[model samples]
Target: MSLLFENAIGDFELSTATLYSPTNGDLEATRDEPVPIDGIVEYASYHDRLDHPEKDDWIAVPLHESDSAALTGEYIAFTDHALHGEIFVYDDGDDYESIDRDAFVESTLAERVRFWHSDYAPDDPPSYFDSPIAEREPPRRPLSGDDAASFFDELESFVRAEMDAQRDANGEKAAGSTPEALREQGFGAIPSLSSLGQPEDGTYRFRIDDDGDDRAQDRHRYVQREFGIFEGNEVQLFPPNAERAPDAFPIAATVGSIEGRTVRLAVDWHAIEDRSTVGGYLRQKRRGYAVTLLLNSVPYDRELEAIARVRERDDHRALLTGETAVTFGDTAGVKSSQQDVELNQEQELAVSCALLADHLFCIHGPPGTGKTRTLVEVVRRSVQAGDDVLVCADSNQAVDNLVAGSSTAATADERSLHAYAQHGADEFVLRRVNAGNSSNDVVGERYATCDGRADVVAATNSSAATLDREFDVLVLDEATQATCTASCIPLARANKVVLAGDHKQLPPFSATEDPPESAAGMSLFEHLYADGGVYEGVGVQLRTQYRMHRDIAWFSNRRFYDRALRQGRDVASLADRPALVGYDVGGSEETIDHSKRNDAEARLVAHVVDELRTEAGLEAAEIGVITPYTAQVDAVRTKLTAQLERGREVTVDTIDSFQGSEKVAIVISLVRSNADGEVGFLDRPLDGPRRLNVAMTRAERFCALIGDWYTLRDSRGGAGDGTDLYDDLHSFLESTGRLRRVEPEFIPIPE
Candidate 1:
């Protein structure tokens, strides 16, 4: 006699058997005949791990849960011959067929009752199961051929536009036009170079010389700063007199070392062998020969290569389509915890969904939500399961946050991410791969330089592409701020991808206007959840926030999140603290030189900072002053520094620089209070006003907004001018008694 069990989920095959016994964890099964009625089934001794068994002819059996539970111990006693019939089993609101009762009774009487399970969970049963695989929507189509080319072209064009904008902002142009054009101008036209030292091995050395031109010096500094050539970056080297021949064009070389004004270039042997290339440039002209460094083309070429080869790779296809060969169920034992405090329900669900994802998963994290905490838990569990994981983000600061954990710990005794990571560091290797000089004392002191094999590696998205090995999973934090093509370089190296970001906060930015017909200008994180995208209605959203007070969170919660955001357990409300305080400075906005600044607003902010310091006893380090423009940042920082007591340092920066940061008390300076009601980039169309959302969510206890109410509310910046957001804030603050006009000396919280 043989028993046959049918699975409710159709996609996966029965790979392992599980039996719950009080003494031993493994299942003990002895079968005379194998069955393959519907799905692949296997039965073997608990001690002997067996592969799929051969198909056999077996009669169906019916069994009840109560009857199965009653029979305990090693085996159950049953009659050899009984009535044959199928059992209709309802498992968690789903219906499926079970083995014949007579076959099961005889089989169980001879052998123990067998339970199907996954190989990943041999000790524990699955705590939760996702929706049936058959019910899920088909994976989205992957971009290929002409569509792929067009998408990459638009993405590259957007990058170029941003580069050009930066150059224009700094009042500097590119080095030269093209190879042919540079050759037309004499080799002397290029920047002069001198030999650094004697050649060693395959490395060619040169020193960048000051040609007595200020513009040339500025351009060199720009290249070094923008391209990060001193931080071991690679750039294309074009000798001034390099032959115009096809093979003698610019050659790729690594920035081996940079000291003072000298640089060492590690050129390939092939390029060094050719007399017309780098070797000849270094050997023939030891001094006075000009060389041009092509800094812009490196990223463009790398992105194009990733796009060109993505479709040919299976993992890349999976990343694009959200389909994978393997699937997972939530591990029941994995609990979400930050040291001692357990995670909220929404955060726990996000952790489960991230693990259960087959190919791609998107975690929609609103501001102040415990998305990072949730993601770190997922990383710990993934490493425990012996999967090599890669964590990446658009910025080095975001990556450092993931590695070192939160600086603003919610609880006083809460342990940091480094502590959590160090707990399991002995079990597996953890490495921090940074491309920039960003380092906090927390992460920098401990993991400043970790080499060799690593079970988990944290890096920026740009640096992840340079890794030699692939990862089992890639966790991309702050994914919404990176372009699709920028994400593809790391996306190509992993089989599964998890994206965690807030789409409502900010999308990928382009200095130039987006192409009229290209969706590639948007971030992949937003694209996946938009309208008919693959993970559309399927991604998990963390609804609870632990950082902001309820009053401070109310505007963004209602405006952007549709009131889905709520305060955590101990979060303060209006009754507990002055959460949302507004000061209508009615300041006159003016553009000094070329940058925008408001003198009245700056003075008002300085007064507020002074009051907070004298009355509330809040130090400058505890408070943050944020603005929208660089000139305004300088203005606020200057005024606050001069007005405040000596040795008081207040953190002041633009909105973009403070994306992944928070503070105890925060103030914002809206510098566009002009008569024309021109808000500049504050109210851009299509992209929405995400900068305001980011700015408002940074405060934990108290938040203050100082702006010209008339200019903001009566903006004439066409459709979607974002005036409605300011209107909403005004109404909310007025109704809640949080709005106040700026006085000579004002207090954040009225006594």
Candidate 2:
């Protein structure tokens, strides 16, 4: 083998070597194979394993000045003890295989030194073997003048954080444990060696031995914790026993499909040398053998690949630099195509500019502003003009909304993409790419099975990576909830891009507690409104909102949208009702059992929910209770269940989970009512109370905020904009006769 393409670095005894591959895309474990090296390796100073003496597998191979320069690239080596190697290969020159050379070298230097022994050939046993440092700083974005590194860093942080959070939420697990021990702890395990088939045929099947109590009975029970797992979820298949096969590594695979108690995984055959060896290894004890399955929810592997491809495009830089910015109405000189549906002036302008743009276009959509409908119109025109369009959203629900239009009464007359497709106006291929369990799967098969003949494809941003074909236009929905790095996944596959979202609502869900200005939590939609952002001079704002009453929409319009959002529906009939109301409680907020809660405020919330359902005649489904704390949500949910009539249920959730949902009446419990006047995360000092904005906008007719007025009005007085937002809210409520104060006896607080 050529030295540059060789998999082995140092010559060691084959029987004594242990191959190491990536676990969850990180160097977390070992497996079998000749370690393949595909990138350059940097030489860091080496340490002698004899100094520690406890590390028996590590034998420092002395590097001579004569051959150090020739062994610079990556390699696999073995010497005295069990073999362990790093693998980075240019398997296929596709976007995913474009190795970040700087990232590779940094990892090698930080972990351990890899040197080649010139005295021995690949077949000959050379000097001592090399062992990596026991611990390593998680791999970070390499600032190698790569434009896509920032997005990669941010997205990687989210992916890792989400995985860690999920693991913590699911309860911790031991690294190595017996099958019975794991099963006793509610973890799934497959006992007895049966059969392992190849997934190269698009579907892989496996059967477990059915004999003992440990047999595969209810396979679905094994995966009950992971039933919601989507396509491309990470998985690790562990060997029967870690002590017996210390050198054996877990096989890595991605979920393809799940049926009953059976899970189908797409194994990376290129990484594994032979399938028979894996089968033989599992068949060691036959009936006595057991394999443990670990499913990880890190779903951004393809996103990293998408970043590599987007970084190579010239339009990416142009869009960032504002050279390709296209303003609304710039289409005045361009030919306008007739659409089947009638669009308002702003929607017409948005669609026209999107059609005229050769590179990038952005629409700043406020809450309930029909942005999805406008985007659908843009897609309609693009597909009619013979342009293949790809529509992507951060969530599966958002993608469905974009295709079927937002769930609002005013939009009932609006035609959905599926409805349009039913008309057969054009013989175009429309497809939705989603997981097997998604609501859209019943519509048709995934885009991959369409035989390369799709005119329009809609999918979640992460799912868009499954597409191999390119498109003329890419329309991204719910852009505010998506990080710029995640947006690059679909952005790389299209020639021109159009994004529609409301940045004033809740920002992207982040594991980091940093401010929105920080790179850690910023969203792509927020990036467009930043200094010198693409929206600086050319962006369009959808001003009309159709979801809320005029009185209900006024607060968001004046406080968040700068009075730019106009009410689309007339609300003269709601003048007799209390549209915006606040009930003040005198109780103080306290942190109990690591959760923020106020018994007085929670009781008041239950009271309000009762009034809305019984007195106001609103159905249970038309009412929702929103809070900033999970403890508060649980408290209110419990109180409502105990106090409300039997069979009456109301939705209670945190503000973050209720962003895309709306109700006829919304009751909010600001959980941070305290003597210290702390408003907590509700009033963001830097980001302008985004959670509060979402809470207030969710109501269509009636909105009630229950809190300690003194806590909100007097809290955070010295802080910048955050304190002023609360003060303004208090002022608005008082001036409009919406603020109502109640005595302590009105709602009883539990002792």
Q: Which ten residues in a row have the lowest lDDT in candidate 1?
A: 1-10
Q: Report RMSD for candidate 2.
A: 24.2
Per-residue lDDT of model 2, residues 1-751, tens digit only:
1121121224323334332332243332222321222211211112222122333443322222222323322222222222324323222323212223234334432132232311122332223322111011111221234543454455556656655665443333425555567667556544443435444455454444555454445555444442333445654555556566534446655667655555665655565776666645544432333445454443456656776686667667445433333322112112236564556788776776566555566788888787777886788778776788998888877777665543232232244565454323444567778644345432433222354577889888888888899998899988888877678789889987888887777777654444445443566656654333434533578888888878778888988788998878765323346888888778767775467877778788888877776677878888999988888887877788887774137999988889888988889998776656667666665544878888988988888888777777664565422376777888888998988997657785343
lDDT of every predicted structure (CA atoms): 0.60, 0.60
Off by over 4 Å in 2: 1-298, 321-336, 406-415, 423-428, 439-452, 513-516, 529-535, 572-576, 588-594, 646-648, 686-688, 715-722, 748-751
C-alpha-based local distance difference test score of model 2:
0.60
Q: Taking the tens digit of each residue's C-alpha lDDT, what string does model 1 give over 1-751?
A: 0111112222122343222222231112334553222221222211111222331222112221322312221221111233533321212223322334334323432232333222111132222223322113344544555654465466666666655664343222224354234434431123455665457766777766665555654554443652234434444566545554336445556667665456677764564446554455455545654433434345555665666566668656554555532233323112222222487877766666676554667888998888888887777777775578898888888888887655432221122346455433354567777534566655555554555677788877777767889888889999888777778777877777889898777676655544212455567786665544545534778888889877788788988898988777566532334877887777677676467898778888877777667777777788888888888888877777666784148888888787888988888988877667777777664443788899999988778898877677664554333477787777777788877877533533221
lDDT of 2 at 435: 42
